[model samples]
Target: MCPPEHFTVEYAINPWMDTKIAVDGALALKQWASLRDTLTDLGHLVHVLDARPGLPDMVYSANGAFSVDGTVYGARFKYPQRAGEADEHRAFYAEKTDNWRFFAPEQVNEGEGDFTYLPGAYGGIVLAGYGFRTDPAAHAEAQEILGRPVISLKLVDPAFYHLDTALAVLDDRHVTYYPEAFSPASQRVLAQLFPDALLADRSDAEAFGLNLVSDGRHVILNTEATAMGHKVRAAGYLPVHVNLSELKLGGGSVKCAVAELRP
Candidate 1:
């Protein structure tokens, strides 16, 4: 997780971003600190990636790269506004990590923003989202790098621009997502893959409910996802809440700020 040092909504890349509505930098910092602390309290190591200037969306660190085992598939952003962030991620990995193989992607992919790895689901599979921020060709590239079957799920809703905005992999076996955010074929694919999936209603989804992270049992929900909290509890996962109303202005929540680095 990177600190929201330079976090702001200067550009309107996504629907949630509005340059007119000014961001509370101090509040965003507090929210980021809380998220880091909360995850720390949950026994998760929160790695801090230094934030760079001119990249407000750097706060959404999950888009940096995708790592599993010892292999890292570095991100190649679609939009030029976020293009610099990819190199920042690559540089960080080269400087910080040990013995991890890194691959600079040729295809356009937004790392964890589009690729979600379920280490234990279907004996391990990557549910890759496309037709939005990520390119479908990137799925094959990722599958080769990670040595896992990459399932292409197409995103339709502009609001749910990234896959993380519409889906949360709660654990190896469980997931919760907004069905409408995906295309009909994609929705059917998900239903076939996760038959017992927890479906989030439009209201909860619009509240940024699906943008979450889970340590299998504990799911950290964003602000105003009240219905999501109830749904997760009903599905037997503990709902840990956080107030990221300020961060939500930039269209990201817990999952976006936190990148999963699997060993």
Candidate 2:
């Protein structure tokens, strides 16, 4: 996780980012610290990536790299603004730990922003989303890099730009997502893959409710997702609410601020 020390909407990259809108710098920092604390409180180790100047979106560390079993698949951002941030992540990995291997990709893939791992014995299959920030070719490239099957899912909605924005992997066997954010074929594919998956309503989805993190038992989500919270409870997971309104202005919340390293 990286601190929102330099977070701001300098330019509109996604639907949520509006140049006219103002960001509360102090509030964003406070909210980010709270998010980090929440994960630590849950017994999860939190790592910090130093925020670089001219890279405000670096706070959304999930876009930096996708790590699994000590190997990291580095990101290649579609936009020039975030292009340098991926290399910074590789540097962080190089400096912090040497036991792991890192691979810089030739494809335009926004790391965990498009890749969601579905757990399996040997590093599971990756549910990869495309047609937005990630390129379809990145799926095959990521598959070869990670040595895992990459299932391509297409995203059609501009609001739900990244896969993590519209879907939350609840656990190894379960997931929750907003169906409208995906293509009809992708929606059908998801339904076939996990029939019992929790479906987020329009209200919940717009509130960025599906942009959450779950540890199979505990779900960390935004405070505005009341309906999704109830569904999470019904699914036997504890829902922990966190207000990321300041960060939301930049098109991210709990899940975006987090980049899980499965080493």
Candidate 3:
């Protein structure tokens, strides 16, 4: 994870970003530190990425890369603002680790922001979101590279630009998402894939409740998602709340701040 050392809404790419509202740099750092500490306390190993000078959005490390079966798929950012981040991530993985293969995508794909793994009885099933930051063609390329079935889901809402912002995969049988963020066909696809998944209410979804990180038993989410927390607990998972309001100014929260290394 990279700290928000250079984080700021200098320009607006997503609907959530407003250059007029100044981000609290100090508060963002504090919140990011707390999140890192919380993950460490939860028995997860945390890896820090060096924050580059000009890449402000580098703090949202989930968009950096996607790893599966020891192979790292580097991001090809759609926007020029985040274009430099792809190379930095590739270099980090190339230099910092061994026993990993790297594959830079030929098409534009925002790493985990659009590609999420779904755990199930099958060996591997990936949910690929597109029609926003990610190109739909990249779905096939990702599937070929990873050798997994890729389910393409289309995003319809500007507020929920990335799949990570609109949905959270909670183990094999369940997921949490905002139905309206997806196109009607994608909504049907979700219903078919996860018949019993928890659907987030408008209030919770607007609070970025689906922008969460789960470790099978525990879920880390925004403190503002009070109602969503109750639902998570009801579904048999511990809800850990963290105030990432300052980071939200830059259009991210708990999940965005993390990048999982899948084996």
Q: What C-alpha lDDT values do all the predictions have?
A: 0.91, 0.89, 0.89
TM, every model: 0.98, 0.97, 0.97
Question: Which sections of candidate 2 miss by over 4 Å?
Answer: 121-123
lDDT of 2: 0.89
User: Per-residue lDDT tens digits of candidate 2, residues 1-263?
Assistant: 88988999999989899989889999999888988899999999998988889999999999999987788999999999899999889998898576678999999999999998878423577888998899999999988888888889999989999999888899887889999989999999999988988988778878989889888899999888878999999989999999999888989888899999887
Candidate 3 overall lDDT versus native: 0.89
Better of 1 and 3 by TM-score: 1
Off by over 4 Å in 1: none
Model 3: per-residue Cα lDDT over 152-203, one tens digit each: 9999988899999889988765788989999999999998888888889778
Q: What are the per-residue Cα lDDT tens digits for candidate 1 across 1-263?
A: 88999988888889988999999999999989999999999999887888999998999999999988878999999989999999988987897567578899999999999988888898899888987789899999999999999999999999999999999899988889999999999999999999999999899889999999999999998868989999999999999999999888989888899899887
Tell how far residue 134 is off in model 2, in angstroms. Answer: 0.3
lDDT of 1: 0.91
